[model samples]
Target: MQQDTVLVVGGGPAGLAAAANVNSAGYKAVVVEKEDVLGGAPILSGYAKLVPSGEWAKDAIGRMVKRVEDDANSTVHKGAKVEKLEGEAGNFTATLTNGESVQAGAVVLATGFTHFDSINKPEWGFGTYEDVLTTTQMEQMVASGKIACPSDGRVPERVCILLCVGSRDRQIGREWCSKICCTVSANLAMEIKEISPETDVFIYYMDIRTFGLYEDKFYWKSQEEFKTKFVKARIAEVTASGDGRLLVKGEDTLVKRPIVIPFDIVVHAIGMDPNADNPEISQVFGVGLEKHGFLERAEQYTNTCGTTRKGIYSCGAAYGPETIDDSIAQGAAAGGRAVADLHALVQKAG
Candidate 1:
C-alpha cells in the first residue's frame, strides 16, 4: 500500500494543480486521467483563446501540465478511469480501468463537468443544420483558423450566438445558470470579429453576465470596438432557409415582438452538465452529490475543499462552474486539506 499517497482523479487543471501541491508537501500523488492527453476541456476542445486574458489557451494550460509531468512524486495515468473506490479516509483503494489499483490516504475528485450537448435541444437545429454549432464547436472552428459556414465554406456574413442554450431553462429541468457561458460567449464574439472583421456578430442573450471585475472589460470592448450587437431575447427555434442560410426565430423581449433573422451561422452558447460519471464516482467514494449533480462540498460557509467523506475532497468543475484560476486555487486548498488529513492518519497509526 502506498502510504501518504493522494489519488487525484481527472488530470485537468484542478487535478494537476492538486497533485503538484501534494508533491510540494512531500507526498506522492497519482493522477488518473480518462483522456489520452493532460489538459482537459481547454485542450480536448481545442480552445483557441482563453477568457479575460485572450492568451492562447494551450500555452497557459500547457505550463501547468508540464509542471505535473516533471514532478517526481506525481504519477499521471493517462487514458485511465477510476473503476472502483473502496475503503475510506486513510486507507482507500482506487481500482482503475487500466487494471491497476492505487492505495491512497485521500482522494480528490476533480472530474470536471461535461459540456451540455446542444443536439438535445432539437429546436436549435445543431445536428440538423451544418452551420448551427455549439460554443465548443465554434471554438474549434476558430482554432482551426477558419470560421466559415460549414454548408458553403464561406466566411459568414452574419453570425448569431444564442446564450444559455441548455441552462436556466425550467423546461429542460436545468434551472441553474452555468456561470461561465456568458463570458465565454462574449469572448468568442470578440474573437470572431477579430478573426473576420467583416462578420457581423449578434449575441441574443437574456442578460450579459460579466460577473467579475476583470471580466467586464472584454464585454465592454466587444460592444465598443468590435461592433458586436446585443439583442435581449432568447431564440425560440432555428430553421434552414431555401437559400441554405439559417433563420433564427425568437421574441425580442425588450420590444415585445417576434423577430426572425437570417444568418450564415448560429452558435449555441451551451452550459455545463454534470459529469456523466458523477453518480458512479459519488457512490464509489461515498461522497454526496448536489441536486444539480456536482460534487457536494462538506460545508458551504466554512469548509471549501472538504467533501462529505472525511478523506475525500473535490474541486474545479466537479463542484460547479468555476473559472480556471478558481479551480487551481481550490486544487491547492484540496492539496493542503489532504496533507493535513494524511498527517493526522499517520499520527494515529503511529
Candidate 2:
C-alpha cells in the first residue's frame, strides 16, 4: 500500500510552504533537500529585507522552515536529493540519494531559481572591478548596515545601479524579465540612502517597471522621499578611472546624448535564471521542460500548478521567475491540490 505522504522536492520558501500545507491537510510530507540546511536562496544567499513586507529574509522565511520542521507529519531529509522517481499518480516510489525510498501519494517540485551571474556579461565590470557588485553582494552590504566600496572601504559619495542585468537582452538569450529586479533595486536605493544619507543613488534603467502597488511605495517613494535619481539610459560599459572611481559609459535616452559618469561604486541589479540543476531534474523526475527551461505546467488554465506528469506538481520559480510571497501561495495551492487529487484517486480505487 502507498503511504499517505507527499514528497516535496527542495527546501525553499515554496517547498516549505507546500510541506506545511500537506501536514495541515492531515497527510505526511517528506521534504528532500540537497543542501545541508533549508531556506533556499533567501537564506543561502543572505538576502536582507524582503520586498513589500520589509521583514528580514531570515525572520520571514525562517518561520516557514520552522512551521514545516516542527510539524509531526513532516519528515525532513537535508543534504539529500531524489535520485529516481517511479510508479505514478497516487502510488509513487522515490529513491533518495541517501539510499532511502519514500512511497508518496503525490510530489511537489519547488526547486527554485538561480541568480544570474554578472560575470557572463564581462563588460559590466563585475569580475573585473572590486567596487562593482551584484545586487546580492550589495544586499549583504545593506544587511551589514554599511554602504562602503569593497575596494577601499570608503563611503561612496555616488553610487549607480544598472538595471536589467542578464535580463530582457536578446544577445544573452534571456528575454524574459526577472519580474522583481525593479522593485528590489528601488527599495535598495532607499535603504542605501537611509544608511548613507550623504550618498547620492542613481538608478540607470531602460524602463522603470515598479509595477502595480509598488509604483507608489517603492519607485515614486524612492524618488520623492529618498531623493533617488532615476535615469533613462542603456549602459554600454564600465571602466575604471585613473582616480580609482568607476566610469559608466551609456546613452541618456531621454536627451538622446551619449554620456559617461564617474561613480565611487556601481551595482548590477541582476536577474533570475532557471535553476542550474534543471536538466538533471527533468531527467530524474520525467517532467518536461518548457521552452524557457522551467518545468512545464500541464495546462495553465485548468491546472495552475500541475506538472507535465500526472500526480506531480510544480510551483514557484520552477515554473518561472516569482516573488517569495507568490511562491508560498502557489506552494500551498499545489499542496492542497495534490492532497485533494490523492483522496479522489483513493476513493476511485476503493
Model number with the top lDDT: 2
lDDT of 1 by residue, 229-302 (tens): 99999999999889999999999999999998999999999898888888988887888999988899999777
- Cα displacement (Å) at residue 273, model 1: 0.3
Candidate 2 per-residue lDDT, tens place, 1-350, comes to 56479999999999999999999999999999999999999999999999989999999999999999999999999999999999988889999999999999899999999999999989989999999999999999999999999999999999999999989988887988999999999999999999999999999999988888999999999999999999999798999999999999999988999999999999999999999899999999999998888889999999998998999999999999888888999999999998999889888888
After TM-score superposition, the amount by which residue 340's alpha carbon in candidate 1 deviates from its true location, in angstroms, is 2.1
Q: What is the lDDT of candidate 2?
A: 0.93
* Per-model CA lDDT versus the true structure: 0.89, 0.93
Q: Which stretches of model 2 miss by more than 4 angstroms?
A: 1-3
- Worst 10-residue lDDT window, candidate 1: 212-221
Assess the local accuracy of residue 42 in candidate 1 as a C-alpha lDDT between 0 and 100: 90
Clashes of each: 0, 0
Estimated TM-score for each candidate:
0.97, 0.98
